[model samples]
Target: MTAEIDRRSILQVIGIGGGIAFLAGCGAGRTEPAQTEGTSAGISFRDQQGRTITFERPVTSVVTIPMPAASLLVAVDGGADHLAAMHNASWVAMRDGILGTMFPQALELPHEIATQDFTPNVESVRALNPDVVIQWSDAQLVAPLENAGLKVIGLVNNGKQEDVDAWIAMFSAMLGKPERATEIKDHSDRELAEVKELAAGRSGPGPSILYFNRFVGGLKAAAAKTYNDFYIKLIGGSNPATGEDPLPGTGMVGLDVEQVLSWDPEVILLGNFDGAMPQDVYDDPVWKNVAAVRSRRVYKVPLGGYRWDPPGQESPLMWHWLGDIAFPQEQSGLRGKTTDYYRMLYNYRPTNADLDRILWTEQNRQSADYQQFNAG
Candidate 1:
């Protein structure tokens, strides 16, 4: 909760006050006037599933059943003032990370809409009287909420870079905050462009990386065309798990020790799920032969406002961090970029220790703070 200047500077550069005027001057003929606070014409737009939805008026109250939906809403809507309730996953992620630190008021909101397994409770959602409900594109889950007479907007979050722009556009239109959406989109575009430019300077193929969450049940990796694979490609690294068929609807494919050894990835990125630590990988005898472990290139993905593995507001930050890790010789300005993003978006100026906490690695997993954050 310390980076107001960074946020102000972003606004100043974007000319936020004149953003609408600039759009008007673009000469892009529109079919309808943009929705505003009290427009009688109401709001209408197509959601991610290609369903046309029209509202009688601008939405002031919202309930999000998916964690990413809440994260995107918070980014475009500024804070959680409009959120009536959220999924339990979103509640926990926000409570323990930069989102809660910056917007403590969000902690006071109710989170009784769904359970950890994503089972929605209709009665609990009805009690909140939300203007709309945002969730995944699952028909069965969404049908019940719609039957309860709530406006339901379905989004398919596949974690691609394109999904980021789509979320910004969808939420901006729904909340009647096009200006904020433009600002967020512009910021993401600028950061990603810089990272892409850095990648262009590389003379050879990037390192091979494998991103996985758990190793107990089986080795599940982010396969090609999935959300996590999108990040791997963005960082200029290649995913060895690509081309293999992913588990149905899960976007992950199974791997065995022998298969992993064959791929011989130079880097391994452990997802910040289930309190996984890099030490867990290093200690396993079967993994000792992997090139990543031998070279000490294994690292834990960072978790800030949200987990970096998925498409959320903090994705651009992840791009910068991964680029620097993959090719340090290019100097991707990782620290400066991370500091600016935290200040501008989360309104929190990270101290050196705070940076360490956000970018928790295997070396610091035993610290009291890291333990507390992952204790859940």
Candidate 2:
């Protein structure tokens, strides 16, 4: 068992901030170092943030700070045996999703290495003696851990589909299992190509869909360069929020009731980052008049190994789910595809009830489009 660190007690003195310390490997168009006897020989790879990371010893244990990195590791490495600690949100996602059931040890791993917003708790991280820590590119988040003598493989904080692919590629390379990433990418590529063909065949432009990034405290919609925007456009749907500009340091923009009313999207998507649901949209008096709410087009994004909303291993599934809703004419067997994916990735087939939970079948059952995904 890993020793527990007093995370709350140590933060005051630990002094944390962010920066990636480049250890070894070529820099910007430089030639790869020749394999020499005395130096330039170790586990070396460039992280997604384009920083080169090299370790003299094998990475037997890892601390994944980014929310989805932990699950990505489990998928790429084929188990959670190498995980030392992960972010709290990552732990929660695992606990609630199928990964926790498949790799129970991960649920017991500590999440005290980083705080709620991914700030590194330097002392807490040091206690675990992880071989490497997967971190984000935020300077405040990476600097502190580097100062504490931890090696960070920095990844960018973005929701693009390529970013998800980059994560799989980077992690699999780091684990000395590059083939795993190739397999994952191949599956994703095949599905993405299929979805694109379906989109091209659609007769008219798809419905206008609005993605609520946050609806509990205030309304924020995904717009421009977000992964939501990528898929919304891919599935033949147009983002009504395309013109809504995002404020600095975020990918989404703010809105109010009247603003949303003006757009009057044909479909509304509630993200998995919060607890807001389709029922919440349906129950709201002010929202009752909206075309999507009135038509029961609002839906809560599904959660499987991770929340299928943002970006992760199950994006192909998310694309199909969204496509089915926005263009039911092209609906396929999502339940069977999900079963096949699980068998290939986790080596375990989900039960009908598991599929229901993963697909949000019960909560979304009211929507006619959701019935096609039901297992039973």
Candidate 3:
């Protein structure tokens, strides 16, 4: 939290150390933060923090300090025209992830607005002259930015499915696209429901799944009540990581080597946050006896507009990816859904190679049931 990621490298630094070291609870922000006033014509509304913000006219420019907000802004606004500046971590998400492909101009935008821990770079953000600043609701984070007289749209996400809806609604309203917000919600609802419906069909207890937000520094698992665990349980899978103590506000907990062996999850998922990959786990003798490793069922979560491990615009896709392996019996259209999702949201379809990259095909091809994701 004390460090500042250098802005020159184009996403070399991630806010939580690497891939969203922070929790999505493993789902999208569960509720909406910013709300539109009266009708489509209203200019006043409350943010998730319940603070009222009234714009004299339309919002023409925005500075986003939260990591996911930048890509989300591009997604709801359908372009990069309104974004003035973003956090360095946000830049890494797009430049290294699929959002960069959808909006290349975003890659060139200024990302010196905040430090790695989301401390607002008041001078830089002020110079950007944005109409409003979108940031997290943490008092420590929001106080300085607000103290500078910046009209901040502070967001609070609880990692619920409604959180993603609220984000789409908030961004759409900010963009003056009420219809677009409805479209985004409908799409999210349809897909999320589809995954849930299919997951409900399975009768038996699903495989024991474990997700590691970070693996190299030590073992960190997505504990219960987090977005990560939410999706795991939502998809009918069991999370052995729940019930243990979690680091407050972060939504994950640390575990000793013996603790992991005790759970011995049937399927292991490597988060995009850390440098650890399938090979790292495969090579580690400590994990060899684990059921997931023995069965070769470990996988690296996919990264789309935002890291799939945490909630973002592409969260439903994360569910399908999990279903592809954990419930291999299902005819999960991993490829088609991704292609269709991109087309529906960005109006740009991905090629087979692009889908392959998003799904980590090259790295996960050898994992058990991974072939289920192949273009069939």
RMSD to true structure for each model, in Å: 8.2, 8.6, 8.7
What's the C-alpha lDDT at position 260 in model 2?
A: 87
Q: Which ten residues in a row have the lowest lDDT in candidate 3?
A: 5-14
**For each predicted model, how many residue pairs clash, with residues at least 3 apart or on different chains?**
0, 7, 17
- Stronger candidate by lDDT (1 vs 3): 3
C-alpha lDDT values of all predictions = 0.67, 0.76, 0.73
Alpha-carbon shift of residue 264 in model 2 (angstroms): 0.7
Tally clashes: model 2. Answer: 7
Q: Please tell me which predicted candidate would have the highest lDDT against the true structure.
A: 2
Off by over 4 Å in 3: 1-42, 243-250
The digit string of per-residue lDDT tens for model 3 on 176-287 reads: 5656667777788887888889887878888888999889898888775567877888888888876343333346677787888988889999987777788778889999
Ranking by lDDT: 2, 3, 1
